[model samples]
Target: MADGILRRQIQLAAANLSEAIDGADGFQNTHQSQHCESAKFSIEQVVFILEKIHIMWESVLPRSIYRRSMFHVLGPVFSRITKDMLLIDDMAAEETLQLQGLIHLALENLSSLFLSLVENDDDEKFLDHHTWVQLDESIPSLKKFRKLAELLDMSLKSITAAWESGELANCGFTSSEMRNFIKAIFADSPLRKECLGWIVATPA
Candidate 1:
């Protein structure tokens, strides 16, 4: 019964976040320089919901359960953003730059929030744990989506270097995802072709 309630709460939060993300389509299409100063509304909504969860459940929930629940809430949220926003074709460079800045701010705020919620007892255990590590860095889809966000605004040279250095794979990107993102963000060119080939030949 308790688990069911928790699940419902998480689902509700996820739904709210998805709605916020859907509503942000207009903001995303425009060059909202002011909005990028903070996180996007959708991302801020996530942080707000998570903060509520931390306040309500942190004392009652087991540490592992609390951590897992947070990820459960975030997984769908990140997936929605990745699919609807990040994978767009024909995004202008200015838009990509703004999006990346928002992403970076979102990540920073999330990391800070996660760290603040860590209990004193958890300090030693989580001493080396970045939020991504503590919250489960093994979620490849989530990590890859973030990596793709960073890659979105990078130059072809930097991207190829990252691919060559295995950073993309290390960040949990699949070959297909890498290729698709490249195709979506960049135009056809010799360098783009070479990068795509490298992505295919190299194991992700």
Candidate 2:
């Protein structure tokens, strides 16, 4: 029963996070009015969600629940961010770089906290527990999401090279995802068309 309750709490947290990202929650309206950019607004909302998760890790939840809860809560968030924010059309290069930095730092901090690494002014101190390692390794989405951030800023040649080498496929990216990413990030050109064809030809 305790496990069920904890799982439900996490599910609710995930739902809330999704709502916030979708601008269903109140934060989006106020902030979007000022920024007038939906993608940037969504990234900020994700940062806010991460901050709340950090507090829960610090005080409310037991260490034992951290791995399970984080995986449950953050997995879909990775997908949401890719589909809604990262895969958007006509995103400015400058804005993409800035948002990439923001999310990369936020994710790094979360990863450090999950590993029970003590963050200080100078550097982080590692803890002697393997549970966090298990959590990190178990969630394939986390790895893909970070890679997606890198791919967002990569050149077409580099991106296609990574795809050809099976790096993106090994990172858990679907052909559909590659198609969408290419369409969003690259303008219509012979090279872009060729990349899209490659994605279509590849098997899942």
Candidate 3:
């Protein structure tokens, strides 16, 4: 019963993300206001899924059995999603569209991982090297995503600082929204810290 509910929730979340990606693609090259609105709606869908995944992590699954491998595979994905969602509101339309595609990719990978876990009933296999290999293979892409997100975050901060100091006035660049967004990104995302904790606890 729990598995059924969990699978249902995952499917719903994946479907929403897929729809968001398709919608974003359709709006690509449209007016900025329209594109931004679509992107914001898509981000809300992703955030909804993130919240569901967090609940599944804490409540649906047995922590003692699944915590290590489950978090191992999903932690970085969670971190990337949180970081990307935080930045999406301020990103250009094309960038948000690109991020939607990336989020879809992560969701696909996560669904496959969860399917594998369900099929292999033996808990022993969960922590085996094969599982580790599967989890490890995903790390590189996630690491790349995190690196890109960090760079983007830094760039946004620099741009915001420059604009605040009136250095970019001649360029007509202004960011009244970015400073508040950056603060909210860092201050509100406890999931980012939790995901990092899982990474740190992972064995080398």
Instruction: Write down the TM-score of every candidate.
Output: 0.77, 0.72, 0.36
* Cα RMSD (angstroms) for every candidate in the order listed: 3.6, 5.3, 15.7
lDDT of 2 by residue, 118-201 (tens): 223435455334543444366667667778778868988787778878888888887877777778667799999987887677
Clashes of 1: 0
Per-residue alpha-carbon lDDT of model 3 for 75-174, expressed as tens digits?
5445445444544444454554455454554444455344344335664544455554454354444433433333333444454444445543322222
Candidate 1: segments with Cα more than 4 A from true spot: 26-39, 116-132, 136-142
Candidate 1: pairs in clash: none
Which 10 consecutive residues of model 3 have the lowest summed lDDT?
Answer: 169-178
Per-residue accuracy of model 1 over 10-125 as CA lDDT, tens digit each: 88877877677766563355355554433376667766776777677667788778767776776776666666654565566677776776667566666644654444455343
List ranges where model 3 is wrong by over 4 Å.
1-5, 26-31, 64-140, 150-204
Poorest lDDT segment (10 consecutive residues) of candidate 1: 120-129
Candidate with more favorable, higher lDDT: 1 or 3:
1
| Backbone Cα, N, C clashes tallied per candidate | 0, 0, 0
